[model samples]
Target: MNHTLLRLIIPGVFLTLATGCVTSTVDEMVFDEPSEGIGDATVVILGRRHASDYETEPDFIECVGKHIAARDKSIEVIGELEFLNALYPWFEPRTAPLKPSDIDKLMLQRPVAQKLTALKTEYLIWIDGSTVRNDSAGSMACGIGPGGGGCFGFGTWSNDADYEATIWDFTDRAEVGRVNTKATGQSYMPAVVIPIPIIAPVQGTACDGIGEQLLQFLSGHY
Candidate 1:
């Protein structure tokens, strides 16, 4: 990790209430996921690193990050950005713009370009470029309400989403496989008493459901 870049990022991250709240802990589902054993790999959960995005609550990036960190930093847990040394150097927080970064220019450095190093990481796991939004209002209404319904009902819901994952080997530093998986799950909340029927209940959260799908997918891959 670049100390210079991390310093700027850590403060920015701590600004958010949830920042640093994520423990480098692993989830049982992800940590126990079987790995044939990546020769030498480091994987990262990639997405919005900006603090603003994470403050919104239920960020998938945390799920992915914690999922790896909890696994004892082994082959199963990896950082995706290790692929960008010659490509997207700006991920380091330098004053560089994204113009100099080219995903295509980077190759898996693990087994091909360099030997897997323990300190730097040798595997990269990417969460992919995609977002999941809850469009199931009906579910929310039925899930919550006057004697409301199940947590997955009208106001209770778990949504399905698709994020393309590109797995790269840091040892070879070359991408090995890409998988498109749907993360799905549900979050339950109490019915907020309001002034009128026109009141909008709390926003039914469903992002974690989509995240769970990603974890499940990881379980299958190993």
Candidate 2:
């Protein structure tokens, strides 16, 4: 067995396992093979601003950062806090929302680009989207109209979470790829007393799916 055979066999095992977990779609928007490639560069994962509160879940952000870091040893992964610090007022979600064009302009600025260059931020991953309650059926009832009232009924609801992770190559100054993740789950609330929790697996699924695909891209595996 040669080095090439080992490389092929080992990574294939990981990829197989990764693909089995979630449904991931990768779209390569503009890919021009870089001369130096993604060798040991810094990768920043960021959550985009949204009006909805659930869009910026800390758990989801951390999940992605941790998984991406774990996937590749050579590359440096920057967490949400550090990345936000680097962007400062411009990327703040509380204020006006920013479009890709706005970011493109900022990157074109010499000072901004120089600052990011100093950080060795070769790739920028913009993560957005949320999991939300889709529909509800049945209902738990409680009423008191000047008289003692106690009501009970079983209720059920479902949640759907969809997310997208877009990759931008800072060195190339262009959008390179994107990963889309969608997951839906159901849960039931028994009576008006006991609450059953059915956690939607979207964030975990997105983290795993996006992280694996990104690892493959940066490591030149897929």
Per-residue lDDT over 1-222 for candidate 2, one digit per residue giving the tens place of the 0 to 100 score: 699999999987755543312233444343544444477678888887675566657678788778866766677888778777766755677642244445567766687767777888888788887767768888777666676665577766676667777887775566777777766666555655444434445456666776776666676544
Model 1: how far is 10 from its true place, Å? 39
Find the candidate with the highest TM-score and give its number.
2
Worst 10 residues of 1 by lDDT: 19-28
Model 2 spans with C-alpha error above 4 angstroms: 1-37, 50-56, 93-104, 107-111, 141-153, 191-194, 220-222
Deviation in Å, model 1, residue 44 alpha carbon:
2.9
Q: What lDDT does the true structure give each of the candidates?
A: 0.40, 0.67
**Model 1 residue 200 CA deviation in Å:** 18
Q: lDDT, candidate 1, residue 135?
A: 52
Q: For residues 42-142, what per-residue lDDT tens digits would candidate 1 score against the true structure?
A: 44555433344322222555565565445434435433344344335434434222221333233233432232243355334454334434654543232
Best by lDDT: 2
